[model samples]
Target: MDINIRRAVIHNVSENNQDQLRDTIVDAMQKGEEKYLPGLGVLFEVIWQNADEQEKGMMLDTLENGLKQT
Candidate 1:
């Protein structure tokens, strides 16, 4: 079977409102399920693509700090 996960993720959430998106993210994280990782990754990809330089820098900084703790 052929599947485009990024496209599927985008299509699934394209119409979601802010609260709904927040809930979806929170639910996925709280579940701590490996299956949710791909969706989260796709969401992060969209965020990365749309983010301005400063936003991307901030994300990188946050990730750096997160990794430092682990």
Candidate 2:
């Protein structure tokens, strides 16, 4: 495979670790903030930029519902 493709595959795998896509988004946010706990607003931006429409919708619904249940 091409180097770029290989890198992308590896990155996607790392992002999808833990069986929860949210972890990837959260990790990105944390990195941006240079901290352990990520801010919700930054997380939203990172997720929005990276996720497709379907994934974005799913994540939004999941997060909203999860929030409501709290």
Candidate 3:
């Protein structure tokens, strides 16, 4: 069986509004299930692709800080 996880994740969330997307993310985080990680990765991929240089830098900085904290 071939499963395209990225495509599946994007398809599932594509129609969601901002608040709904927030709910999806927050719900996934609160659940803390391993299954949700790929979905989150897909979301991050979309964000990273769309972000400009400054936004990417900020995201990278935040991610670095988070990694250090953990």
Candidate 4:
């Protein structure tokens, strides 16, 4: 089986409104399932591509702090 995960993820959420998007993300994280990781990665890829330096720095800092907690 062949699958384009990034494309599929984008397609699934591209039309979502802000509230819907937030719900989707929150639900995905709350579920804590391995299958959801790829979708999150795709979302993060979009964020990374569009984020400015300051935003990127903040994201990295947040990720760093999150890892420290584990």
Candidate 5:
């Protein structure tokens, strides 16, 4: 097994490298809008599509109780 990383190259990066990483990520996301997820939409879609009868009953009970607190 072998692994290699250039520590000196990493250390040479500018002082603002944290912000540089954030900017790079933002740029990548701007370039890939179609790949981004809306969190709640994905959650509900998975629950609706895959839940069994037992799971559906439990989920409805949880949701009903959850709504009463709001």
Candidate 6:
């Protein structure tokens, strides 16, 4: 059984609108289930690929700050 997680995740959410995407993310996070992590990673990959340099920098800064809280 060959499961392409990234492809599956992307396919699942490909037609989602902004609000639906937000709901998916929020639900995943609130549930804190390991199964949802791959989907979140795929979403992050899409965001990273589409982001500008400044946006990437901001994401990095936010990540850095988030790490400090842990």
Top lDDT hit: 1
Over the stretch 18-39, how does candidate 5's per-residue lDDT look in tens digits? 6875674566567776543333
List CA RMSD, all candidates: 0.8, 8.6, 0.8, 0.9, 14.4, 0.7
3 or 5: which has the higher TM-score? 3
Clashing residue pairs in candidate 6 (N, C-alpha, C atoms within 3 angstroms) = none
Clashes of 5: 0
Write out the backbone clash pairs for model 1: none
Q: Cα RMSD (Å) between model 1 and the true structure?
A: 0.8
Q: How close is candidate 4 to the true structure, as a TM-score?
A: 0.93
Candidate 1 stretches with Cα past 4 Å from truth are none
lDDT of 6 by residue, 1-70 (tens): 9999999998999999999999999999999999889889999999999999999999999999999999
Ranking by lDDT: 1, 4, 3, 6, 2, 5
Residue lDDT tens for model 2, 1-70: 4455434534555545454666665566667765423344444555588999999889989999999999
Give lDDT per model, in order: 0.98, 0.62, 0.96, 0.97, 0.57, 0.96
Point out the higher-scoring one by TM-score: 4 or 6.
Answer: 6
How big is the positional error of residue 9 in model 1, measured in Å on the Cα after superposition? 0.7
Which 10-residue window in model 6 sums to the lowest lDDT? 5-14
Residue-level lDDT tens digits of model 3 in 5-38: 9999999989999999999999999999999999
Taking all chains together, each candidate's TM-score versus the true structure is 0.94, 0.39, 0.93, 0.93, 0.42, 0.95
What is candidate 4's CA lDDT for residue 5? 98
